[model samples]
Target: MTAADLPEIKILIDATELFPSSMLGEMVQQFLSGNEAKEIWLVLTNPQSVGVAYVAPEKLTDGTFNLLLIAVHPKQQGKGSGTQLIAEVENRLKELGARILLVETSGLEGFELTRRFYLKNGYELEGRIRDFYQDGDDKVIFRKVLT
Candidate 1:
């Protein structure tokens, strides 16, 4: 997506309340401008923006792609949008010769569905960082072997 799409994308992500609205614009700008990462993908539903996925080759790692961000609008949750987005990403990563795809999320009550989604999609828990987000929130990393 382009930098101009950030405002609407930020709104969709903010609806999930998974990230701070203040930080999304900068992140989107970095990816869109190719200032930090290589590529990003967005899923739109007609006139409205519904989902987004950002991915980049891992630094110092061979054939690894980081699934930087993936979010679907709150209203569109459980409708297979997220699943389809992730599947498309896997296909693209495979085409790029990536052997592994990694995604990280918070270990909080609100993020249980996210963790489950990854697992249901064949990702395994690879690691966890305690109290990464705050005093109680942890960072959980999941890895999927694309081969």
Candidate 2:
């Protein structure tokens, strides 16, 4: 998506804390313009919504896509929405020549549900960064081979 898509993308961020959620538009624009990745893939809820997953090209050493953000409206959870979104991403990334996917989640003590969700979705825990959240929470890294 382009920087122009941020306004709509912010609505999706408001449904989750993938980002500050307050500056969804600005955040998306910045991500889109940055050189951190070769490309960014955004999947929306529909023609008028912003619930999405931002998949960026991996960093210098990792030859994969980084799942930067994935937020679904709470009201839409547990209905296979997350799975569908991920499936779309998997297909798109495959087309882009990606061979693996990497994701990281904050290990906030109370965010067990989020951690479990990733595990249930076939992401295997690869490592952890101690106290990575600045709130005494760790950061858990998960990976899934796409090829």
Candidate 3:
């Protein structure tokens, strides 16, 4: 997504509960200096943005990327937008010669659907850190080798 799209995309982010809506501007601004594809960003524009994603190279690792955040508007949640986002991110990373993509999510009961989404998308259940987010909240990591 481009700088011009951030305002509208922020709505989607907020709707998806990905992060605090207040932080989007500060976060996206850091990646917006016009260097193309250094970070893989995408927004699904079905009339309006229904999804958004951000990916960055993992520090201290060669060709390893972190799918830092991805969210689809709640209204569009079951409409394949999320799958399309993942496919696009993978395709873009492959073109960039990336070797792997890692995604993390909370392992709370409320996020079981999210964990299943990753598995359905071919990500392996790689690791889990108990109480990483607080008591009874684990950090679940999923890995997809792009090769």
Question: Which candidate achieves the best lDDT against the true structure?
Answer: 3
CA lDDT, every model vs. true structure: 0.85, 0.75, 0.90
Over 4 Å off, model 3? 35-37
TM-score of 1: 0.87
lDDT (tens digit, per residue) of candidate 2 on 64-127: 8888878777767777888788878878888777888988988886778878888888989999
lDDT of 1 by residue, 83-139 (tens): 988999998888878899999999999889999999999999999999998999999
Candidate RMSDs in order: 2.0, 2.8, 1.2
Candidate 2: where is the Cα deviation over 4 Å? 2-5, 30-37, 46-50
Model 1 CA deviation exceeding 4 Å by range: 34-37
> How many clashes in each candidate?
0, 0, 0
TM-score of each: 0.87, 0.80, 0.95
1-147, model 3: which lDDT tens digit per residue? 788888889888778777788898777775786653478778889989888989999989999999998899999997899999999999999999999999999999999999999999999999999999999999999999999
